[model samples]
Target chain A: MSIGIIGAGQLGRMMALAGYPLGLRFTFLDKSKDTPGAQVGDIVLGDFMQAEDIRRLAGEVELLTYDVENVPVQALREAAGDTPVHPAPAILEAAQDRLDEKQAFARHGIETAPYRPVDSKEALETAIEALGMPAVLKRRRLGYDGRGQHFIRAAADIETAWEALKGAPLILEGFVDFDREVSLIGVRNRSGETAFYPLSENSHEDGILRLSVAPAGQPALQSEAETQLKALMEDHGYAGILTVEYFEKDGRLIANEMAPRVHNSGHWTIEGAATSQFENHLRGILDLPLGSTRPRGHAAMINCLGRMPALEPVIRFADTHYHDYGKSPRPRRKLGHITVVRDDRASLDAVITELMPLIKAAEGGE
Target chain B: MSIGIIGAGQLGRMMALAGYPLGLRFTFLDKSKDTPGAQVGDIVLGDFMQAEDIRRLAGEVELLTYDVENVPVQALREAAGDTPVHPAPAILEAAQDRLDEKQAFARHGIETAPYRPVDSKEALETAIEALGMPAVLKRRRLGYDGRGQHFIRAAADIETAWEALKGAPLILEGFVDFDREVSLIGVRNRSGETAFYPLSENSHEDGILRLSVAPAGQPALQSEAETQLKALMEDHGYAGILTVEYFEKDGRLIANEMAPRVHNSGHWTIEGAATSQFENHLRGILDLPLGSTRPRGHAAMINCLGRMPALEPVIRFADTHYHDYGKSPRPRRKLGHITVVRDDRASLDAVITELMPLIKAAEGGE
Candidate 1:
């Protein structure tokens, strides 16, 4: 009767909010007794590595999925047993490692920046030679946002960059001449039926997602993104939501990374689309027929990082929607997001103009 | 931190659903441990009169509200202490008694069917003498749908009607030659700022509400309904949602009853309006600026009484939205509802024609 989620974050909380109206029950497996998801649904407090806890959660629900990509893939597989674990642990495993993610993309004929594994100083030197200057060095696993990446400009900067990221298995990724950052999300069901939402043009500040505009640019770019996404979904046999973030350069989509679960860029779908990504993800996992993925209007989503802004001005806008994650305010953590949706382009732009400054001030930004 | 609701039925369940994305927490007090609201938020199982349980819930939340009119008014007043209770217990008490509700409407210059108190068989005879034959006899408190009414069509029927309802104080009222049944829901914040949703034309079967069409009929009727609603809200010193059901005959509005909390007919506002009645109720209690009350599209809501239909066909529609209140199916009980919203009248009518039969079958209709 209930759906179990591995991580109790904003995405899990939103999924519960969407699923509740459909008679779907929700229970979360979270490490913390108090979490954003716990505020909305039932929580089973335990670590992801606890096999007993994972199995206990699986036994209580009809199916399993996750909010975060950092979960232990094998534990999910082991716990799922005869039950369905959507988007599959294999997909999570591929998304967990940067080297494997890029390699998987290449195998699926999706373009990616050239990269090579770097373990020792000799391997790093060889990779630098092959990838060229201004290459980025990153830890292969447990990396998020910009936490694990260091840019190497020249040979002199190598030692310091290596000292900063040494101990973990690393990958050197060559920099691409990208014009803009965009993300495409597609959902697939167990029956092989697939639905894709609009492409989201994204902006990140200090490696944290700051803004996303839905139906990014125009139709042609979105079509190409969909083509690449469908290929990835078919190749992996994904059964829930999958998102691929791309760097658009000279009208070409070069894959930067893919999240096996829902992405932050699709938050606008809650108010902008006819059916939200969260509900579609549940529908896909449940193997129900998917809903329409069409956008109702133009949407601009701004993340509320570090602190929650007062909601008075935001709700005053005709079609604006505010979502708070109910997490404690931190220096750089994402606290919430506000989405402004409008049937016309002008109202959308007007709200975006008025909101950016307010959100920026809340985040202690310049 | 959290909003405490007294009755954990579908209404409280929905309030929690709407409030969660706004970073609101919810806790409920209900007699039943297994309630629809318990699936979404914390539930404190206790009777409404249990002061200890009510006090504990009040202690845990920022404010309190109720989903049903059946809760003990004095207990809520006792538990609220200094913490705000929206739509005030006074309004709840007024809504509880049919006589008082009609009197309040009359005080606000809203016309109602002619009525008189009937405490005894002698009083009932005198009331029928003034109101005429085919008058209706109703108990003053704790009645819903058509449960507490009996018709006095002839002299022979008077003894039977009196025998059935003589113990309780009753009201004998003349019937209105109404052309249609419509309801208007208006919300007022503590600041006295008011917003009204368009009138909803409703259809009832066997005294239980069956269907509601939003943005009902013409603008003139909606305006008159809004005017009467504003007067009632102002007279009650009300905050939060209030709904007034009306009988429209000869282009005149006659108030039948008023609900101090969110009403069933306004359920379409969840998906049809830019902002839902649940969210606005929370905003009113918290004194936040209300969201837009404009309709996003035309909406039709059909109640799924006693059973739930298969969800596959419902979600397959591009604009259909399904809600299941996780209660066990029972004969003649209010179960769940489905709302379908569309941008045009043709599609709205098309969906209404498509859904009525399916919902009727699910409810085990005759």
Candidate 2:
């Protein structure tokens, strides 16, 4: 069977890699043949935003999925006429906008920071007054990695923040005084068979994910996160991997956002878990039996941003695995990642401490 | 960097899968585009036996390797003029003929079954008398999986066995009444750094490999096997994975044959070991630091001969990994394989018992 992926990024490339062993082929829809996915699978050169282009790809494959979240939901719904698109386009519609996402979470009884929709400067000031002084104003759509969002620390900064993100659908959320950030990845099949991986504690630098360590968070928190994710998947009638990021404050999880796709925080599962998220996503979407989400060991994943460190120094560590997406270097680009699997969390932390400086040095340039 | 593989078989396909994470690209040389390797990487449509075709592939990549064993050594040597072909063409020459392989093993203090070269029918009968009534006559070259060989049970069967295999250069060997069969896989880099995986106990049906369970032999036996493998690699100045099958009789190892490339017995390493054989082969050939060969758990790999069982039933067991080479069904053809990893050998055996019947039934043309 062949699967058509809407975006040819590293995620799609990994999905193809994971799917190939199950006797599945992949065709990627993207503008360039030089992408990471194109290097491994057939390429259908087209724009993800165009329904006709998506239809061209949908015509050739048995199922459709996307590695990128920015694809237009209407285009996907129209293009995927007869073929199935997993996670459903409706879920994408909800995940694309902040207000809709928070509403979905609320509907599922998941807790989130206080928020109110803001469309005008008058509404922004009113939302700030109602929510409190410390808040964040974010565009409702197409915001990721700290983009299209601004923080308001005081009343004086509220107008400046409004000025910066004006003329777009916006949401004002009360600032979360988070102690730690973590995420839970779950997979559900069409039959409603679901499996959830242990929480991964994530660290970010300038809003870009820098490090992730798996099997983090307390068991109570883990179970709570899984229950919330299951409820969300059930609500959406979802089939595929779903990731929810949470802010932990005083032993409680405040849901921040959800991505209806395989996530970067779960990348360590490639070697640390019994089955990886990419493979489970394919299995769940294809309606096969979901694999075990058991962690094999403690694992840490370090993202190599802007530039990748030399392969020799990284792989020299025992049980270390290197991943290079075959991408050219550009400032702040996610060129590759390194994963280290250890028997215990302390050993994992020790190695990460020694490994971080080398990776951080390379991010400056080469 | 790109590597050119001489044959687009399952081995080459797996090598590409392992190399991709390390940011390597592959181009393969084969007559048919409908091969396991071609499904994942670019294909150079040509015959592996033709020197000119190999030269075309060698010209396109920085490094060269082969998955199939029958490639003409002269062709590889001539084609890979400057571009390094790992395991070295010289090692391939030594491994191609059974007599030369045995001689090379003996030089490294590796014991083998007693054998004598034969030319004519008269010579075959004379050798049979010297070796004994219960013996085996095998062609000296291009023989595998019980092909090109005949068994001599008694005096009446001697002439018949000679008549069956008389036309080729042959060897009559004293049959090994072995207790069990096992293989040791070892890797050497260009810098002569060496690593060895634990021995895998193997089972065969009609001389075709059916099952392999790794971390099987005693620690003393593993050390002995490693020493022998190191000597053989040092003698040849070899780089890349080398496998040697052994007949374990009364706790002693009798060398059988050697393959100068990645072997099937090591497939369990893909999930069972800290680092897989395919990745290690690439790291070795590329002159990178060799990965740790620590076994993660007890693992059993069952070859899916003739046909593959349904993915649903096979993958129902937790920690089970399925690999389908996408080959058409043929009687006794190696089509795919399933690997089961468990925390203990008893658990591994239990899963195999349940999995075997399903796979065997599929081989009957399901």
Candidate 3:
């Protein structure tokens, strides 16, 4: 059966590549006629907000899902009548708005940091007072890769942070003294069967993900987080891959945000897991039995941004796995990722250590 | 850089797929527009026998190669001036003719079943008298998958065997009392660096490959064959993936024939090896450093032809791996393959044992 994806970026391209081998064809939609996914998929080029394009995409495929969450919800809702949209428009609506998402988590008895909605000067003042200094002020909708968010360390920085947010619907979240950022990437099928991958500790730089190490060092913390994440997915009747980002503080896991589609943090699964998140997402949307989520080994993923430097050194290492996403090079743009899987964390760490030099060399660093 | 592949079959499609993540693009030449590879690649539709199409394809890419070896030698020669045709026309010339291939092997001190070229009735009589009854007669050129050959069990069957060859250039060979059929697939670069995958034992039915098991059961036997295969390839300065089919009889490995590109028997590498044969083939032609041929575990590959079967059983088994080549279904056409890797022979055997029932179910058998 054919499945239409709403974005033709690298995520869509990867999903298309993964789905094709499973007898699932992909039809991709994007405003750019030559998006990366379009290079390898049956593509329909049009604006995401265009009703005619959404209708055409819905008519052509057995089901509909998206590569990114920025597609207009109203357009998706209209097409949902023709083809089932997994994780549903409601999930995207909640995920799109930071305040709504936090509320959803709170309603489900899922732990999240203290937060207050702020859309105007009065709300901003009230939120700053309630959440206190050292809070994170973020745009309510469509923030990704560390964009559209600011850290407020002092009361004096409130006005500047507010102006940066620019009257967009916003949320001011109380900062948690967390030790690490971990994520739970899992899939729930229509039959209510859920499969969770091992928890991964994510590291970011300049607001973009730098790396994700799977079976994230703390086993008990990872297990506790997965239990809560799966329950939250079941509560929503979510039927697709979901990634819950969280902060681990004093052995307690607190929700930060969620991605309704395959998350960047789970890219290690391509070589490290028995079944990749991309493949599982296809299986979930197709209503097929979910494949295994077992990690093949301890895994670490490093993002390749802009241009991939010389891969010779990484290729020289026995355990380093390279996956170039085939997107055009641009500054700070994620072009691909590398996954290194090994029997122990020590080996995984060694691979990452070895890769640092290669990555630097590729960046034209001495 | 882009490479032009003469055919858009599964091999070419796989080559294109492997090429993409490495910054290599491909333009395909096939009679049919939008063939499987063409769906994800640029297509230049034309007959291989036509010079104009060859010229067009040559102009578009940096190098040229074939998915199948049947492309006319003259066409390849003409394309050579624009972009080098790898494995070279010399290799193809020897490989296409049974007599020439055997003679070349003999000159290299490679062992083979006793054989002689036969053209006329007088020559056929001399060949049979020398090679004896119960020999096989095979048409020399354009034969594959068990076609264009006949077995003579007795003197009475000689005339019938000759008739079956239909006046094509042919060969007569003494029957081999082989215990098993095995093959060695390897790649040689222009710099003369070579890497070889462990020998694989292949099982066939009706001249079509059914399965290939890597690190084939007998270690000593495989090592001996690998050494010989490497020596032969080095002698020819062969580059790209070369597969040499062999027969093991009385503890002796005898050369059978060779294919100049990635062979079906190496399909297990996609999921079972450090780097797939397809990826290495691209690396070899592009003059990149060769990759490791280390098998992850004992790997067994099963061919799926005509229709893709229900994958529930295979998916349920933890060790089983599936790959669908994404080809259109036609009677007796190869659609895809599955590879299973396991820690031991018992687990590997279990997957194979379970696979038969699944295949039968897919074929509508009880």
* Top model number, lDDT: 2
Q: Rate the local accuracy (lDDT) of all candidates.
A: 0.88, 0.93, 0.82
TM-score attained by model 2: 0.99
Clash totals, every prediction: 0, 0, 1
TM-score of each: 0.97, 0.99, 0.96
Question: Once model 3 is optimally superposed onto the true structure by TM-score, how far is the C-alpha of residue A18 displaced, in angstroms?
Answer: 1.1
Model 1 docking category:
medium
Question: What's the lDDT for residue A50 in model 1?
Answer: 70
Better of 1 and 3 by lDDT: 1
Task: Write the residue-wise lDDT of candidate 2 on A1-366 in tens digits.
Answer: 999999999999999999988999999999999899999999999999999999999999999999999999998999999999997999999999999999999998899999999989999889988999689999999999889989999989988998899999999999999999999999999999999999999999988899999899799999999999999999888999999999999999999999999999999999989999999999999999999999988999999999889988999999999999989999888888999999998999999999999998988854
DockQ for all candidate structures vs. native: 0.78, 0.89, 0.52
Arrange candidates, best DockQ first: 2, 1, 3
Query: Weakest 10 consecutive residues, lDDT, candidate 2 chain A?
Result: A357-366
Q: Which stretches of candidate 3 lie over 4 Å from their true place?
A: A364-366, B364-366
Decreasing TM-score order of the candidates:
2, 1, 3
Alpha carbon lDDT at A303, candidate 1: 93
Instruction: Pull out the clashing pairs in model 3.
Output: A309-A362
Worst 10 residues of 3 chain A by lDDT: A357-366
Clashing pairs in 1: none
The alpha-carbon root-mean-square deviation between model 3 and the true structure, to one decimal in Å, is 2.0
